[model samples]
Target: MEQSESIRELTQSIEKGTISLPEFQRDFVWDITKTYDLFDSIIRGIFIGAIIYGKPSFEIAVREVDDRPRKGQGKNRKLKIDKFTREEIANKVKVNNYRIVLDGQQRATSLFRAFKGIDEVWFIAKNESDYDYNEILDKNLSEQTLEEIIYEISGNEDKERISIKLSDVYDIMQQNWRESKIEKEIFKKQTYNGDDDEGYDYNLEKYLTICDKLQDIFKESKLLNYYLLDMDVDKFALFFERSNSKGVSLKFTDILAAKLYAGNFNLRDKVDEFKDNNTAFANNFNQEIIVRTLAYIIGDGREKIDKSYILKKLNHEHFTEYWDKICTWYKETLNFLFDNSYIVSQSWMPYENMIIPLIIFRWELGRDFSQMNEKHSEFIQYWYWSSIFSQRYTGSSNEMIIKDANYLRKVAKGERILEKAYFNRLARLQINTKDDFYDYNRKASALYKGILNLVNFQSKGLVSWENNNKLNFNDNRLEDHHIFPKNYIKKRFKDDLEAQDKMSSAINRTLIPKISNILISDKAPSKYLKEIELKNSSLRESLNKHLIPLEIMEMDELFFEILDERATKLFDIIQNILVDKQAYILQNHYKEREHQKGYIEIFATYQNQEIQAHLDLETEKVIYKNEHYSPSGAASKVKEEVSGKATSTSGWHFWKYKDEEDEVKLIKELKE
Candidate 1:
């Protein structure tokens, strides 16, 4: 029962250092991203404080007991007990040790920030709550208040948040009462159930009081120097780990790397400076890989390394030698192939199309390549997402791609003949006309043919190609717009067999414009074709010219039919690109026993090293191209899919209606 006035008086003295915040108190308890957490507790009237002396330097906490006889009023910092139930206080009624909050880690940290200098400490109004999607999509949010947004989504709109006065927080903790105040015993809380060391589990209410006290001290005292000596490495690790509630946890290994060179010196900070680099942790590679590399680079066995290890390791002497190599690998190994588009947004590898495995090259092949090698950019991008083909790929197709990655690596390392084994079809390309897929694949028999074609074509450049006497697109920027919307198709159709069959077919999807996707305005092309033909004369005429096969103009079905023809032409354009892609990989076939895994098929080339040892290793990749038919014969379908979802009757099990004895009739009843 600390009185507001008494607590203010004591807090004023505490700010003067005449009194001190006790130790072993709980932390400020609130839920804000960070700054908001500090703000909300004060506004809602919760108690927060800090402690100095258990482990490390200190611990942030809410005070459980103090110097008071019964509990009428308190005098230290401003205090409030509106939410503290008798049960909660009773629980912490026993333990006693030193009793003064020395550091309000979270609060002090928060208030020192410019944003927290608020009307008092920060405080979100008690009215805030959940979000309603239906409301957000249709309602005018511009005119709504935070409370209103919450109300729209939350049935319990009237629920209030914790609140308290700023002055009373730090003030009420420093009182000189005649009798000792017994606080309820607080237990070590659990944040995550995975492991004891996993997450932060602290009381929120106690933290704000500490923030208030620290804020006052910062204002009253002109102490430019911060002495977080008690806030040593362990506490630093603990405090930082506990803080992140909404986002992801900062890996201990990363922290270990960070700790290697503690101080103002930044380890990961340099990553921010690079162009097109997402973070210090990843280049074109995703964040997880970078972290894994960091773990391995430190030689900390991957699992043992963390921020602490990093902090301990970083220094002027060793930081450069060890970290420089990683940075080099990051910029080169990672950058060479990380096509942002190919990276399917996964934790491992930038694009799970499998370019991530290339990092292993830095160790196996060494760093002879630079990120700026324009000649190799296409090679790298293809390799990064090469797995897209690999996952669905098999046979010579896969072997071809492996040879491709090997070829690139060898070529970079000054190896010749690496391109010889890479067979690419180049016969289709005519100096005067557009070459189709089969014509191109014909040139793909040898790596040299395709390489020559690629070198010739690329060296000619698009400007040169357009200038030549061949049909060319005037537009430099070609966008891959989906013909069938992935999201829209998913939403409108059930995941049943028919819907899935339609959705999965490549013929159903195609690319469109960045500004204007033709798929827009709802009613699909079939429904809207007639309107389009009447609206755009140029489109109608273009459709007539590129009729693909025979009677396109004859059908007169209109826009969709015309659009379908153009889309087929577009697919041809895409097919040509794939042909070049195939040639690129074909010419660069290094095909070491190591990359044999990528090849769907390989020859059994014996080891040149040992005669008795029949073979050095398996000289071929075990993969193959699998041909499949969609439910409707458009896309490939697995045997199971063809038999199960597509078949009219159960293909897996047969029913014998003509059993003379009906032998299984009794068994059927038992089975059921």
Candidate 2:
């Protein structure tokens, strides 16, 4: 095992095609930001982990490192040989002792590109100010701290900083880092004009010191550490799986790809082929979620749909048998979502993993959504809405998938699954108040996406802003544009972060045609509305379609009023869709228990004031200040009243009640 290999040696090896990736290794996917961080760590002499290399007992196919292609893009576009076959390798090249990268392919490829100046060149920017440079150096090199010392030049004029390409540094390091030579090379054709010779010399020395450090780090630092092993392809596959299980950043799909490759099935090529054939579906859903859905379908709710299960149970043969059927089911699932107006595209999906359960649910119900009965359809909608509003599939939702799949199967047979507290509890815990809508911004939030879906549904299908034609969900023409323009908000709010957040809320965004977005660029809502009204006679109707108040155009600078009106409207839409028989049953169930258990007194303290509230056992709500709120809601209400800002609170954790023994316990404790 070689524990010490200089950066120059390894990069040179990569340049000479002596060190290459094996055919089964995943392509490099690291972005420029990661490349910058890697070099930063190298310059700081930090241990950036070791790469593992294996010497095959026999000749193996290998490929040269190439620039990583974009998602769904063809790889090895520049290289002549995508993969040299074992026969071709034996015939073409006489080398058999080269090592294949088992781990750290991303890091190796990034280094190779930076040193060879392929695709994007790497540079280090340091402030020329002596005091600032000293301060930057003295501080501990955290990411934030490094931002002041190192940065990429963006072709902007900056008199206070000097930048040098990494390739140039590599050249200087190769010459054994002579100071006079490095200074002449780095600072050529530039002379100090300052009268202060001492200060100029100090800055010059500092710049020269940085150059020397770069050379020493790259030329002399033994950072390219690796473990050398001799193994066959089968043993290497096992090693890959074992290494990933012990916490490598390799994707499960990567491991699966390696295993499938052993069986003469190329998962990457197959996925790319699928994407090529189905462009629209591919655009909507990512490769990972699609593969995961296939895994879940293969598992069929009996096994966990994870990496281990997929690797062990889903071999190349199983995947081959089910490939066509799974692909068909996924296409059908997309159609179901579109037909139901749940989402027009994958962007509006609350969670990609949510699709896995839906796929299983629909497959179990006979793979045809049209044949689904009204009751079953209604239950599915209930489950869907509850999952979105409650943010059910946020993290580690494999268990939820199995549970939901089993429950949906029973629901298909007219079984009562909603009677269980688990089903109804989702509705109670999430989207309980209008505040939820008010707090939502246009981030990658499930609540935010759910709100947009609600708007689309209420609009009876949104139309293009340019032509009043109904939107076709099949393509990329539909865009979520801000009603209150982001440019207008920036100018209006300036540095007011709270105002910015309010202006950028999902309530301020709506689905519009791409052309309409360009037409309404940066204009105030009032200005655009008036312009739109002048051209279109059905302006009021259009506003109503988007759930926006007609009177909003008349109001001057009343952004808060617009937000409130739109939030209230969206909240009503949510309530109408999600409040069903199950919610009523839960309400009544609580009411039935209230008589037997009376009201539980709950209280808490905030800002030196004792807040008194009582739990309404019947409705499972907290009575505070003569109004009912969810436990968390009451806590937020009290904080808002005193602090003058909305806050998210875990109601169960906030309120406390005395048990029968008179010992005080949290509301969460009681529920548990």
Candidate 3:
């Protein structure tokens, strides 16, 4: 290995296509902030990292050249002939060699782009007092020359200034040596008053000094450190994988994709094309999923989907032969999810990996959706719901997936049957209840998607309430709205994380027309319900169509009761869809309690002050002072009185009513 500490020379080599990235090298992943930071580090003479390059043999180097096209070429193909081939060995290019980047691709790309004056790289100026940093992308100076940029920055402009391209800065200093000498002579000859007359000379001297500094920075060849290794492809591959194992930036699939790239079959490009064709499936599709799908189709059922396994087993021929068939079945699987399960979008489908099994199943059935028997369909649906509710893929996923794939293969061969025993096991799996939906982690769970599909099903189709036009789920035309309004909840639980979490929960959320969300604003459900009801005559039908409980429309404020009732209704609908038989039921815990018709006084001492509230059992409303509220609202009021901020609290747990035994018992306890 040969070592060099020269950024300028390295960047030039990159520009001339002498130091190029190998197909296996990862793309530029650094963002604008990171790019700015890299320049800052370089300016400060910080040792960022070392770049490792693999020097291939003469023949291999020629093939690896970015400018040369593959053997079978077309007139329209974009190719660049190697500079070494054109210059060093002009007529006999066979003896020339090139180095491909094995590490530090991002850092090299960053430097190259900055020197080339690419507008994508931006600097961030940090403020001392304020923690926030201001992003400085000089749009006006992007296409300007170094002199123009310097003139603009020095002018009386309101905008922030930026550094000029390093190469251009170097050129300016190189050309201005005589000019700087003459300026110094003129400044020395001038007889200036000890006043503003000397300002011009001072400014000119400072400008020339700055130019010299920039030249030194750019002309310094040993600014960066790098290692050049002479090795073959197999040795380079082994070394690359071992070195990258310690870092998570590169994946096994990424390496495998690069290997396929050598054979003119770019897995990443194909995945991107697939995504472009099926936008709905794109977000959930990734290299790992594609590799796993390929493994299921081609590998022995026991093989693990990892770097060693992929390199040893998968090759260009396997990919080229199975690529089309895999894609066909994958698309069919997506359509199957939409047509049969009412999951129109990837967002509404929990467990994206679940699609892999379905793909395998459909492929086994020869990609014929019509041939999927009722029993097979039931089994697939059961597996999806069961896996989601059970969180089967949350841990030990790779191992479990292999096992499931093996089982599925057997089922496809008519050697197994999905029976009641499987359903019974699924029934024992903990279902994500209303509370679970409130957690952000559960947002993508199967139950969450199931609920979303249920709403879509009840709506007949997701149509825009404003124009009655059928909405496309793929296009982000709809947004989830809070039934109770976030502001109203916040007013009760101010700056409370738990309260904010609940506001984002599944039970509180409902899909509505994007425009309708704006119209609703932060108004309480009671207020918006009346306004929307007045505008649309079919408001009741619309509510029912959305699977919303009609009881909520009559309420003055949202409460746990409404949430519980709606959750029960939604869970029942999901149960009906998941299983043909009504064998599984979610147990309801809240029961009505016998109480007097009039308001019952409830009291609690908070922060040395007596807090009092009233509960009307008949109306199921709580009265705090002169205002009417639900239990949650009243409890929130008590919390506000104690903490001096609105926060969510359990009214049932906080407020207690006196019993006939002269003992204070929680309202929730009384009800139970």
Best by TM-score: 2
Candidate 2 residues lying further than 4 Å off, grouped into runs, are: 1-20, 24-51, 54-100, 103-225, 228-250, 474-477, 486-501, 515-522, 534-536, 556-558, 583-672
The top-ranked prediction according to lDDT is: 2
**Where does candidate 2 clash, by residue pair?**
631-651, 632-651
- The sequence of per-residue lDDT tens digits that candidate 2 reaches over residues 1-672 is 667787888887776777777665655677777777787777555778898887654334466787544434664465423444345444434464467788888888888777665534444455444445346455533322333555553322234455555666677765665767766665553343122433656555655555555555676646668888777545655677677733555555665665566556677888888888887777655666666667777766666776556655666787777666777777787778877777756666777777767777777777487888877777777778778888888788887777777677766665554234465556753667776776777557888888888777777676655556666766576667787778888887778786687776788887776644336666777788777767666767767778887777886377777777888887787777777556653442222212335577899988888888999876789999889899989999999998899799899888887654344557775564
Model 2, total clashes: 2
- Model 3, residue pairs in steric clash: 5-222, 6-221, 67-80, 492-646, 492-647, 493-646, 493-647, 493-648, 494-646, 494-647
lDDT of 1 by residue, 1-672 (tens): 111222233334334333232222233332235544533333333444422222232222232222222224443444321122223323333221122233443444344222212223322222222444444445443444333322121111122332233333333334321111211111122121122322222223222333344345334332221222234445555654674542435444344333332322344454444324545333333443444345444442222234444444434345545444655665555334322322211222212313323543454356444532544555554543333322222233323323333444444554533222123222222221221211222122322122222322322321111112211222323232233344545555545454444432323322112324234444444334444455554444332222232333244324234434544553454345554566555555333222222211111111222101011123311111233221122111222243344334221121111112222111111112
Higher lDDT: candidate 1 or 2?
2
- Each prediction's RMSD over C-alphas, in Å, is 21.8, 16.6, 21.5
TM-score of each: 0.35, 0.57, 0.56
Whole-model alpha-carbon lDDT for candidate 3? 0.59
Once fitted onto the true fold, the runs of candidate 3 whose alpha carbons sit more than 4 angstroms away are: 1-19, 24-49, 54-99, 105-224, 227-254, 275-287, 342-344, 417-425, 432-447, 454-471, 492-502, 533-536, 574-672
Indicate the TM-score of model 2.
0.57
* lDDT per residue (tens digit) for residues 1-672 in model 3: 446555656666766666666554544566646666776676666778888877643222122223221234542354332222123422232343456777777777777665554423332211122222442333232232222223222111112222233544433543554755645543233333123443555445443444455566666767677787766434655676578732745555555665566555667778888889877667666556667778767775656755456655777778888877788787787777666535646566666777777777776766487786665665565666666666677755776676566556545554452233333455554544545445442455565665666567556565444444455656565566677777877875566676666676677776665553446666667778777766676776666666667777777454566766777776665567554342421111112234458888888776777788788877768898789998888888777877889999787787887754344567875444
